[model samples]
Target: MKNELLSLLNKNLLAVEPSLIRKFDDEISKIPGIIKLTLGEPYFNTPDHIKIAGIKAIIDNQTHYAPNRGIVELREAISEYLRRRHYAVSYDPQEQIIVTNGASEAISTAMNSFLGEGDMVLCPSPAFGLYRNLAKINGARYIEIDTEDDKYELTPEKLKTYLDEYHTSVKMLVLNYPNNPTGVSYSENEIKKLAEVLEEYPIVGECQEVCVNG
Candidate 1:
């Protein structure tokens, strides 16, 4: 039965491997007195205030499943946060804002929504490994833009070169700022230049900014 079930699994998913980040974490966690710096696992515990709020909510029986897009109040807070901190752009919580389980879920959702067989996903090299794995799982070709010469930054010139080569086959561009493993980020000027080049293309940009605050 197990063999039959394995054979029935999606071929694309079968080609995908388990997350390297998680595997590294698992290996390191077995060692006693070892400090783990991999996988972005937080070194500290949840703050007392946040923990207390969660406890209070459970005590109040506020444990029902949230709206598909997430709780209305949480979505509203996200909308407000974007408007204030993210270049003053406003998103309608009711229509545009979606509170995901985490950045991983958000990435998976976006890739599944946009990618298909023969489609291409462009990513800067040395990025989060999940980008490549997700693209493979969705049957999309993942191309890495080698940024070694550019100090680990994706410049407009480099991006334009790839866009010209890939043309319409490129479905998505994964831009991970404060990039995983490398810890490199783009400046405001650098981002604007890249945006100018992107404006001419129809490809979706999956901007992963999870480490921006750190």
Candidate 2:
């Protein structure tokens, strides 16, 4: 029976490990009354409006298995939400958007979709631990760029320095705003400058994957 379980698992499973946050959670939860700022676990509950929507979905019998990409209506809502809140452009939810379980799954799925063994992912430090772990689990090398020297942010010059040094070693540059540990946000001008540097390195191609939130 033990051998059967091992046989069923993929070889890559050996390289994967439990989430680092969960490991810390075990130690912190036993502290009886310690205030932990270790992992970026949110203290708030799901807002009432969101909770009620979940309840309504249950009542309306929306419990059936949704499409792999997720329900079209929900995906469309997300598309509009992004356009209204973040980007100026609109996207087709049916074609361009995918609703994942959460940002964690979204990152993992995106990296898995685009990266393979020997590919490199440039993660600006100090990043969400999940990003580093995701690269390892997906068989991609994770390269950390020290952003502390760049005023706790990735500037165009800093980005170019890395690409010039690593050359094609970088397959993707992971960007996060309102960064996890630093809480630093990028200005629109800063984003544009970074984009300008990215445009010069057409070798890296277009990077559309970005994440925000805890």
Candidate 3:
């Protein structure tokens, strides 16, 4: 029965390897008195105020499942935040905002929604491994454009070249900013240039921003 169940599992899943980040973190964690910074682990504890509010919610019996998109209050707050930070960008809370558990869920949702079998996900090299794993799980091919020679930044010219080469199979572009492993970010002008290149293609761009605070 065990062998039969294993055989029935998705081959794509079986082909996926464990995350090297987590593996390294686990190994290094065993060393005493070492200040480890792997796996995006937070250095600070949860604030007292937030902890109290969470306890209060449980006491008030507000533990039922939230709306599929998320609570309206939270979504509204997110919309307002984007509006304030981006100056000109605004999202409608009721129709456009979705509050995900974390970046992982949000990325998974976007990839599953846009990708199909044999589709291609173009990722910049040295990105978070989750993007590549998720693409494989969705039966899509993950292609990396090495950015080591370009100061670890994916320029518009490089992006356009890859798109042209894999135009047919490419359906999504995965971009990470304040990029993991490299800690590099694109300037405003750089973003605009890439956007101009992207405008000519039909691919969906999945951009991940790393925020320390929830």
Candidate 4:
């Protein structure tokens, strides 16, 4: 029975190597008194008001399944949050937002949505490491672009080189800022430069992939 099960597993299951971040964390945890600068677990707890809201919602029997995209109100909040705090983009809560359990789930879901077997995803190397795993899990190839020389950034020249060299087949590109390991970040000018490169492409959703580590 065990042999039969093993054979079935081999037939059905594709083995993917686990994340380098997770591997590092597992090894680091075993070392006594080792302070991990490896995985980024937010030091601060979720604010009290947010926690209370979750508790109150559950108590109020708001436990039914939400829309596949997520709760409308929550999505709106996310949209507003992004517009108010970071980017100039606005999204329709009903159409454009899908909340997952966490950022990890979000990345995994996005990869699953955009990628399939033989699809190539461009990732900035010496990255958070989880992005590579996410791409792999979707049976997509991870094409790592080394951004080390450009202070770990996605420069216009770099983007141009990849787009020119790869020529249309490569669809997804992931970026990270206030970046892990190096703590490097893009200034406003740099952000605009990257955005300019994106603007010139005009591929609609084809080349629009930016995943910030923060």
Worst 10 residues of 1 by lDDT: 205-214
Instruction: Estimate, for each residue in 144-185, the C-alpha lDDT of model 1 and write its tens digit.
Output: 999999999998999999999997799888898889889998
Q: Choose the strongest candidate by TM-score.
A: 3
User: What local lDDT does model 3 show for residue 98?
Assistant: 84
lDDT of 4 by residue, 12-47 (tens): 134566667788789889999887777777778999
Between 2 and 3, whose lDDT is larger?
Answer: 3
**Candidate 3, backbone clash total:** 0
Clashes of each: 0, 0, 0, 0
Candidate 4 weakest ten by summed lDDT:
204-213
Candidate 1 yields a Cα-based lDDT of: 0.87
How do all the candidates rank in terms of TM-score, highest first? 3, 1, 2, 4
Cα-lDDT of candidate 3: 0.86
Comparing 1 with 4 on lDDT, the higher-scoring candidate is 1
In model 4, state the lDDT of residue 142. 78
Backbone clash pairs in model 4 (N, Cα, C under 3 Å; residues 3+ apart or in different chains), count: 0
Worst 10 residues of 3 by lDDT: 205-214
lDDT tens digits by residue: candidate 3, 87-131: 457788998878888888888888888887999999999999988
In Å, residue 127's CA in model 3 sits off its true spot by 0.8
Q: List residue ranges in candidate 3 displaced over 4 A.
A: 209-214
